[model samples]
Target: MPITYDSQKRIFKLDTKTSTYALLVYRENYLVHLYYGAKLPDDNLASLMYRGRFDSLSPYNPKVEDELFSPDINPLEYSTNGAGDFRISACSVRGENGDTVTDLRYVSHRILPGKPKLPGLPATFAGEDEAQTLELETVDSVTGVRAFLLYTVFEEYGVITRSVRFENRGSAPVVLERAYSACVDFPGMDFDMVHLYGRWAKENSTARHPLQHGIQSIQSKRGMAGPNHNPFVALARNGCTEETGEAYGFNLIYSGNFAIDIETDTRGCSRLLMGINPTDFRWKLSPEESFTTPEAVLVYSDAGMGGMSRTFHKFYLNHLMRSEWAKKKRPLLINSWEAAYFDFDDDKLAAFAGEAQKLGIEMLVMDDGWFGNRCDDHRALGDWAVNEQKLKGGLQSLIQRVNALGVKFGIWYEPEMINPDSDLYRAHPDWAVCARGRDKSISRYQCVLDMTREDVRDNIFRQMYDVISKNNIEYIKWDCNRHISEAASLQLPPDRQGEFFHRYVLGVYDLMDRITTAFPHILLENCSSGGGRFDAGMLYYSPQIWASDNTDAIERLTIQFGASLCYPIASLGAHVSANPRTSLKTRGNVAMCGTFGYELDPVKLTEEERALVRRQVADYHKYYDLIRYGDFYRLTSPTDNPFFCEWEFVSEDKTEALTTLVVMRQPEHVFHIQYLRGLDPDRLYREEETGEVYSGALLMHAGLNLSCVSWESPDGDSLVRHFTAV
Candidate 1:
């Protein structure tokens, strides 16, 4: 196995029983040659998805062992001679007893690009236990060029950590400039796309390349909150293919200098390339340098985040979650709308949490009905105050009391809205996004607050901060019910009415940014009537989202399956079993592919049903780490691969990967579980329930087959196999 990495002294060293040799020069930032031990065809970076940003003339630094590696990680060695490739040494990788460790595991490499790429570009990872900051200075101090970087070649337990940071340095400063682009090259996909955002019904601009067709890209203004936030959400899936290779398959290009074009390859895969335009502000030092806003270009690879492999990818995200226990992930949690809709109160809330706790739940969130006049969601749209009528006490007191019971407390809030009937709306009246001359009817009992306005921004921010600060609130169900309507006003002038959606989203970001900054300890879940706002823009601010309002497991299967194509599992909110799913038709396990949680009334469940919930929790607890943070691979899409949904999560080293096969037998059964990809060439694993032993070799080569399938598991109907290397 060749576990390679590069710094100033770049080199690739392979490990074998016979001997170890340093592979001669290939280009830098190239890993295919390093991992596959193949020669680069022509050995050039011109076609390697080139990302150029005069603004981001810096490098991305990789974390060295001493800098961040845990016990599972050993540092790089140092050579006898100081700094040349032949002389550049590793930090002497030693086993637990300093023996030449032989059981080499992970084979990895990284191209740590430097910065101008501002600090704090939103990151995605699984598992928790976070350090306070991500401080990697990879730029050349003299030239202001960023080249410092690091990568790991693992030898211990697959536990890995992910983090990123930028510590403001130098006297005269430069504005941060960065790009969201991939480094690999692939063949391409078969379809065109329209990147989407805004309302599903009416959307904004659809991005396209110079000359294109059928496929369009929708740039969503939806976002998780932060200061001066510009959401980076645009799609391109033209040249990437799943049929060709792994790692170097798909990409979304972001040209830091040119108009950012979001494009895909020949496969059906997608990417949201992001970059910032040069702005001279936010700079206090140096000659007046240029600045570009950061973009949200996030994509999830399914291979890195399930089962034990999730532990490997955890290294990429520790900066955000900041909690080790949180990294372990909790039981699948469920909320009420999918369970009882808008049901009971305090005692009711307590009952749900208690029952959930019995079933291994870690937290309980009080959804819509617990607030002021919120029964059925028609009234109290702008109200932030607690409804004494429902909880019988203030929100803080209720939360405090709930915490005493050993369960975390979460609440719902929608500050960017105002029902004209609401007191705030009644008092200000001008607070809504409406026009005076024509008309502004209501949607969902309220209108959106002109989040684009400074005052409106203040009001929203203050109230939101108040809720998190004053109360022991651990989780927030941040919701934005209706999309921008009437397009009249909040803060923007009349001529810029069309700018409402974009600016309004900025306002939302401002509020959320403040809340999260001040209360870094809290976890926020974003929901816009479920999948309505599922996009990369929102993922920047929210760790999880309400996958969909439709709780019907069957319908959810379709909805969530479509959603998984873009988002990662950690950000995808799902539950175990909910009161017989409420949908057009009775369904099967609707939520088995996300941060599993329940939203049902514990008091209402029968003993057997409750036990089922408990069992579901156990299943979640067992696999939570695997699904929440591992790489997400969408093997089959209901839209494309109906009747069969196959996916897997592989550890970083690719040693172990878990695959789940969901078989929908409408009447196609020629089973023996063969003919699937990545089956154990060495096949060593077993069915958790059936205990039927198998070889990793046969499993990977011949695959397993199933006939007479039944939708039984309340956890979701599927075949889950854990492939381990013995």
Candidate 2:
């Protein structure tokens, strides 16, 4: 068993393959965090939580009257507001008298064989033999509010998931001001924090800083998980690197307003909290009604940042993704966005399909202009009907024509947005989110639909189902082009306005469930103005996301590299775009690092360039398995070495590996040696291109120097190599 209780020490210990987490119950009430890190042989960890008397600080309980037992200094497992501890709390609640204060004490607990499902949310799932769950119940004696703390330990992955469910057992209703999912306390503050932050065209850029005295956090209040900040954070030791020191990672399984906070106290102790943001969030819990927070995943690695990353990758691939197409080989595709945008007609699309078939591209995705009057971005949103003026013979006819050319067909949609110029918006202006007596704000000439209303979802679903059911569409590119503004829902009362954001996210999950259930074969790829809503929550419905709108090969080196730190390679939708600055070969090398595709017009390319496309398609098919399902390793970081970028993917059985290196323009002649990772030390391997054989130990330790760039073009170059164990 992965979970066990020590009756003598009053401790609950959870263990995985390489890590252990333990908590202590003091005086049969307070829950204290003891330790979490490398595995321990026994559960004798009560000595880790030392108690000391603080002058002028009140004791935890009057009956005990022990000055050394103050709650202010203890490492509370689930800290609450106004409970003698001044640090940031995990939860806060207001009673019927409008006073906000809570003190929840340990009550009882149970251990289950497997993980339980969270209603109306996307969470990791596992079989009975793969996982074990622990449910600990705590209650506020003053208000009869019970909070169920849930933890599930995956024995093989060295991962733990945490969540909370708040139940109002009192007669009067209680308003929950804050309900963060999980909290952890570390002894010292000598650590560096890492997070991803960027704007629209530059998503998932890595940023790291040392822990400060006050709070350091990353959050998103833009309705969706905006491109400005991702819903993830990591803490590493002072001198941590890609393959050294200790690191811990935290991620949330949600796509709404969220916050990841790390606070260093005056005593130099650190605490980390993660869940829905408390700002503009309040949930009213009626008697006997419970509200559950989204699940958060925690990973600990003693082998440093890369170790933490690989653990997350394996966990998400095995547990988070629910679609059948998750592990399957994705088809090579050509999208119409960069080629023609909204000006493409059915005849023009058929030309794209025809060219795609010549190069062996498997799918042709017609983007943005087939429905309503959507020739441009200014109008026709929320109108799902096809416009014959653009397609000439309707969507089905265009799809049939493309399919006849031996290519699959795909279409784009923005179902959660409305344009005032469309019929759907004009019929019911209130369907869009707007504050009372305030001017409505619009972005990209669009208004967000109030997903909190069931009628609104029903209307959008009918229109979508009509087209999807009639056409033989194999893919759907769902997009949201703007952030939400003036987020007031007319369907909710004034006191419940705080509940709008959460309810809106739930509504989206509901609609996704309906669509995916009805059409199980369609390949859905989500894009929020390109990578804005790219997170674990969206991955539940879609296998891949458009990483960014900037498809330049050089720029994507950082974008795709940073994203691979936490996301798997198969989840990034990379494309060879029409960037005239870079060479065709270089573009293909970078795009092949992810879900390989093309975003340019094949007919416009020169004859020589088209020949390169055929070779690239062949390479994609040859190396698909090694790239998609292999263990990733960061060899040389683009941030550390601005002159180049290098990474690798190794097979799980240590028999094969693929490595990619992109060299940028340098100031002078420079020679760099790239070391390979994740191979058997004694095994001999042969490089496919050079036919040179070397032991894995020599390759990883001695490495090979790359200094042949002076003969190449000034525009830079890229190289990819394959190795097989001999």
Candidate 3:
């Protein structure tokens, strides 16, 4: 059992494989955090709590004998507003009496065998025997507000997911100003904050900084989990490395506006809070109404960043993703967006599919421009009808032709967008999202649809269902090319206008639920002008996402490296493209690290290039299983190393390994030695190319020597090494 209770000490100890989290019922009612770190055998962890006397300037002044203790100086399990805790709070409400304080005390707790489902939200779920959940209920005596803090412990992965549900029991309605998912307080400020930050076409670049005295935070208010910042943060010890020391990771499973804040107080205590961003966010809770926040996954890794990443990878792969294709090897696909943009016709598409089939590609995805007047980026976004002018025959005919050529067919749709010139928008202009008296801003030459409206969502859902159900489509590249601009909706009341942003996200989730449930067999890949919407929320609907628009191999090294911090490699959609700036071998090697595919036109390839494509496809199939379900190790970081980048995938049994080494900028020395990891030290492994056997211990400890000169190209050099246990 992962959860155990100590009635004598009134403490709850939750244990995972490598860590233990302890909570105590302080003052017999107030729940407070005790400890969370490396696993301990004993349950007497209450001694870890602060025991010193109150300071002279304390908020709990004069030591009142009968009053509740001041929470400003105490470590609270779930801090709430009106409790005098001035830092980041988990919940804040404005009651009808005009008071904003909520002091909740422990009521009761229940332990269950498996994780409980979070209503209307995406969460990590597991088998009954694989995990356990603890639901702790607390109530505020003044306002009759009840909060249920739910925690699920994955014993094997050392991960605990936290979420909160607040119910209003008072007669009058209360407005919730802020509601966060999880909060963790550390005793000292001796750690560094690490987050993923970047912009469009260069998503998920790593950034690390020492925690300061004040608040250090990362957030996204661009509606979606914007490419500017991802919803992941890690606290690492000062001396932590990739393979050693302690690291704690907090990842939110949401796609809307989010905030992760870490505040170091004057007392040196650090509090980390994560959830939906309070900026431009508010929820109205009437009598008997309840609100549920999204889940935040917490991981404690004593083996450092690599271990932290592997833990997240395993958790997401085994528990978070519910799609049938989660564990299946993804098909090798070729997309037509970059190949022909919006200019290709049915014959051109068929020709591309024929060439792709010849190269062992399993699927051909026609991206954009297949629907109503979508000849360019400016028009016909909401119009989902087939463009007979471009296809000559309807979409079904083209799909059938592609399917007959030994290739599966997929189509793309930007269902959340509307072009002003589109027929759908011209007919129902009110369906577009806009403030009542304001001119709507445009992005990518399109306006966002008012998904907050059920009618609009239903109409779009019907259009998507009609296209997907009528055609023999094997895949769907569901895309959202723009962000919310004038967020207000005409249908919403004045007091409810602040709900538009979060409501839009809920609308997206609802639509996705309908499509995914109705068409369970189709492989779905989510994209937002590339990786803008890439997060755990989207991963529940689409197993994979287009990592970014920039397919340049050199640029991808940093992008993929940062993304691996929280997301698994299988979730990144990487493609080989014929960028004049990069070599084909380099491109293929980089793309191989992700869900491998092609983004360039194969028909334009020369004989030699076509042969290379065949080899790439063969290589993809050869090591498909290992790459899809392996323990990833980051050997070299592109952001840290200026000359080269290296990484590897080692199978669970340590029997097979595949490594890619890329030379970013050639150094003076032409020879380099690469150290391998996650191998059985005592076993002997043979390199596939050279037929030379070496001890795994020696390979991991000593390393492999490669002649960079042989792999050098005009742009850069990329070499992939495969090894098998012998």
Candidate 4:
């Protein structure tokens, strides 16, 4: 069993394959954390709890009788405001009588065979045989507010998912000022904080800093989980490396305004908190109403960041993503957005598809101008009708033409946006999210649709469902181009106005659920102006996401590297684009790390380029499984070395490996040695092209000597090496 309870000690221990988390009920009531690290034997681990005598000098509840009962300094399982803990709280509520203090004592707990679903939220789920859940119920004595701390342990994956549910059991209405999903209290502060941070075109850039006094956090307040900051934080030991030492990760399974906060108090203790951002967020819970926070995935890796990443990848692939195509090989697609943006007709699209078919591309996605007066980015966003003038025979004809050429067809839709000139907006102007008397702010020449309104969401979903059902389209690139501005919904009452952001996210999930359920075969890819909405919540519906708009091969090295810290490479939508004018081979090699595709006019390529495209498509098929399901290792980072970047994917069984080395600038030397990982030291591996055999230990320790002849010559600045065990 993953979870075990010691009733005599009043202790709960959650164990995974590589880690153990133990907590105990101290003083017969208060829940306190004991240990979280490498796996420990299920014996008397209660001594791991730090019981300092000086902790009594910190803040305490005067009403409590115990002398060493300071909630401020103790390692609390779940800390609440007004109970004496002042650093950062998990839940805060104002009672009907204006009382803010909450003293929650453990009431009961139940150990279940499987994980329970989080209501209206995306969470990791598992079969009864694969996981176990522990639910601990605690109630505030004064207000009768009940809190349930739920923990689901995926023993094999070394992951524990946590969530909190609050129910008002008292007579009066309670306003929830702040509610976080999970909180962890550490006994020491000898760690480094690592997070992903970036802007629109450059999403998920890695940043790390040392732990310091006071609070430091990464947050998003732009309504959706904006591209600026991702909702993931990791604490690594001082000397932790990619392949060694301890690392703890927390990722939220939500795509709204989120915050991940870490604080080091005066006593050198650290606290980590993650959940919905309290800024511009509030929920009113009536006596019988309950609110469930999103799930926060926690991973402990004594084997370092690589192990942590592999754990997350495996867990998300098997549990979080629920599409038939989750484990299937993705198609090598050609998108028309960058090639002929708003200027292609039916014949042009058919010609593009014809070229793609000849080069072995499996799909041709018609992006942005196939529907309604959408010649440019300025108009016709909410309108979902086919433009007969451009298509000449409608969407069905285009799909048929593309399909006849041995390529599937995909179409793009911005269902959450509304252009002022669009018919849908002109008819129901109030459907656009805007303050009652304020001028609607425009982003990308469009306003966001008020998805918080059920009618608005239903209308949009119906339009999309009708189009997808009537046509033979196999894929949909759902895009949300802008963030919410003037977040006002006419349908919501004044007191509930603060609920608009979260409710809007729920509406998005609802629409996504409906469409995905109705058309389960479509390959849905989510995009938010190129990686804006690239979050785990969106991954629950879409198997892949358009990684970014910046297709520059050199820039993408960093972008993709940073994103891989939490997200699996298979979920990133990357394409060989004709921007930055890099070598075609380099472009193809850079994109091979993700869901490989193209965003260029295939017909415009020379015969040599066409041959390279054929080889790239063939390579995609050859290594699709390995790249999709392999253990990824970051050998070198572009942020650390401006001249080059290197990474590799090794199969789980250590039989095969594929490594890519990209040179952004000419190196001063003629050759460089690249060390590899995740290989069997006793085996001899033969290089695919050179046929040269070397021991795995030699390649991993002494490194492979890679000549820069091809990189320096006109061939390309990128090299991909494949090795197989002999």
lDDT of each: 0.45, 0.89, 0.89, 0.88
Error of 3 at 303 (Å): 1.2
Q: List the candidates' TM-scores in order.
A: 0.63, 0.98, 0.98, 0.98
- Candidate 2 at residue 201, lDDT? 92
- Model 1 scores a TM of 0.63
Model 3, 307-382: lDDT tens digits are 9999999899999888888997677899999999999999999999999999999999999999998889999998
Q: By the lDDT metric, which is better: model 1 or model 2?
A: 2
Q: How many clashes does each candidate structure show, in the order listed?
A: 115, 0, 1, 0
Q: Give the TM-score comparing model 4 with the true structure, all chains together.
A: 0.98
Please state the error at residue 232 of candidate 1 in Å. Answer: 9.3
Best-fitting candidate, measured by TM-score?
2
After the best TM-score superposition of candidate 3, give how far the Cα of residue 529 lies from its true spot, in angstroms. 1.0
- Candidate 1, residue 447: Cα displacement in angstroms equals 0.9
lDDT of 3 at 78: 89
Q: Candidate 1 on 101-196: residue-level lDDT in tens? A: 211112233422221223323333322221111112232232232211222222122221122222233333332222222211112343233232
Q: Relative to the unseen true structure, what is the Cα RMSD of model 3? A: 1.7
Which pairs in model 4 have colliding backbones? Answer: none
Off by over 4 Å in 4: 54-57, 61-65, 707-716
